[model samples]
Target chain A: MRRDRSIIKNEKSLRTYITPPADLYETPDAYILYIDLPGVTKENLNIKVVDNSLIVQGKFELSLPKDSDTMFSELAKGEYRREFVLAGDVDRNKIDAKLVNGVLILTLGKKEESKEIEIKIE
Target chain B: MTLVRWSPLRDLATEIFDLQREINKMFDRFFRGFEEEEEVRISTWSPRVDISETDDEYIVRAEIPGVSKDDVKVTIRDNVLTISGEKKQEKETKNENFHRIERVYGSFTRSFTLPGAVKVDKVEAKFKDGVLTIKLPKVEEAKTKEIEVKVG
Candidate 1:
């Protein structure tokens, strides 16, 4: 291995994954999670629910012209991972997910037993 | 008062303490996203960016997910390149019960002076997949030139 290649390997070892920013909201019907995942195509994303937690992971490679030379680079291109513990009332089977413009939106529905029941005066 | 002698061990302990605090702060930022705005002069949620130089143009890319195309604006004036945008929250606070509010929503502006003269008219900006790419074509004189030297 060459010297510069070793340096690149060291940099890769320093960071194996990034935790993308996420917005989590709860409504009467469900808990919604919106995560930023730029440069990731829809097919490249992987989402799973296990151990009472919601996990989202995606892999992305930066697309740049072959002739271009990076002068200043702050963005990291690699695997993105985020895990959120699901609430006790959430129904994993009712969860729905969608990808819009590189944003992963996950809706975890609340179980019927968890919703509040309104009472009216007779 | 008598001068106190320096303690190297104590200094090392303090240094490690400071490093631990810094690492904790970075983890907080990574998991929780942006902090609440406290200052009006500058915002803390600026998007990360990358710039590359091609033969004819400079490619500038920024990661700004969840922002609409209409909300973002790009402009070049007085040799300064500016990219500004707002990521608005559409939550109906009255109806929804939020378990958490970690996503940042507010106006953000980033600007920088161009290192070399570029064709303002030829500049192109594209926003897709939550990433903004700006291509600034360099002027003919600003492009790199190479001269070959005869072998000795």
Candidate 2:
């Protein structure tokens, strides 16, 4: 997959949120990040990698009906932002991402120099 | 063999974030009363819901994303409607290195008491795009009736 090289500038000025839940997992060759961004469409998500941190942000647009009444309000509707610090073991060029059903999945491939090599005895 | 309770999500990294959010929520609630609505709005960890009533039906909408259809259940018995289900974690990965866990995962139940008798057979429920919509049709007597007044 082609890498996302266009950096999103001046987006940090907007008010951010800390609610969307995230999970990270690592494999032998890569690390995966899953972010729950419900109600956010693919067009509203922004994924960026700067220096040593990977940032994922999403915006949600939900409007209630004019005649509706909110009996219960729990889920906060706003931007969902999360950042992960890459520890130099990740391959910046090989990173990839996809959003399915409002869940953003980011995979950061491990650097070839960081993978463990099994030694063989003659 | 004896076992020790282990939870990686309970580590210090997540606790600090949770603490910060608590502080922010407190401040929001403190200033919320200044609005025109005198009643304070409370936010919880559960899914948000909206309930509306029309002449023929009462509609309920809930925002519960990322949950599959099989995991959710809706039932009504004795005029008490209940939506209960489990929010399970994503399937196991090769080796998960969790950083933050903000989404709640567990079995949750939200029940609502119907104000008037509804036609149980006519109730219809639909789940789409992680939102659940339930339509409860009101009985004949439960609907409002308009009467004209004679002029003096």
lDDT leader: 1
Tell me the interface RMSD of every candidate, in Å. Answer: 5.4, 5.0
Assign candidate 2 its CAPRI class.
Answer: incorrect
Candidate 2's C-alpha runs over 4 A off are A1-18, A120-122, B1-46, B52-57, B93-97, B119-124, B137-140, B144-151
lDDT of 1 at B66: 79
Worst 10 residues of 1 chain B by lDDT: B32-41
Highest TM-score, which number?
A: 1
Task: Tell me the lDDT of model 1 at B78.
Answer: 72
List, residue by residue over A1-122, the lDDT tens digit for candidate 1.
58997798589568668888887788777888888898777888989987777888898777788999776578977799887888999998998988876688898999999987788999
Query: What is the per-residue lDDT of model 2 for residues B11-97, given as tens digits with 9 covering 90 to 100?
Result: 676898899879767865754421112122232335667676777777877777767778888888877777777676775633445
CA lDDT, candidate 1, residue B137: 99
Looking at every candidate separately, what fraction of the true A–B Cα contacts under 8 Å does it contain? 0.78, 0.39
Error of 1 at B12 (Å): 25
- Model 1: lDDT of residue B142: 85
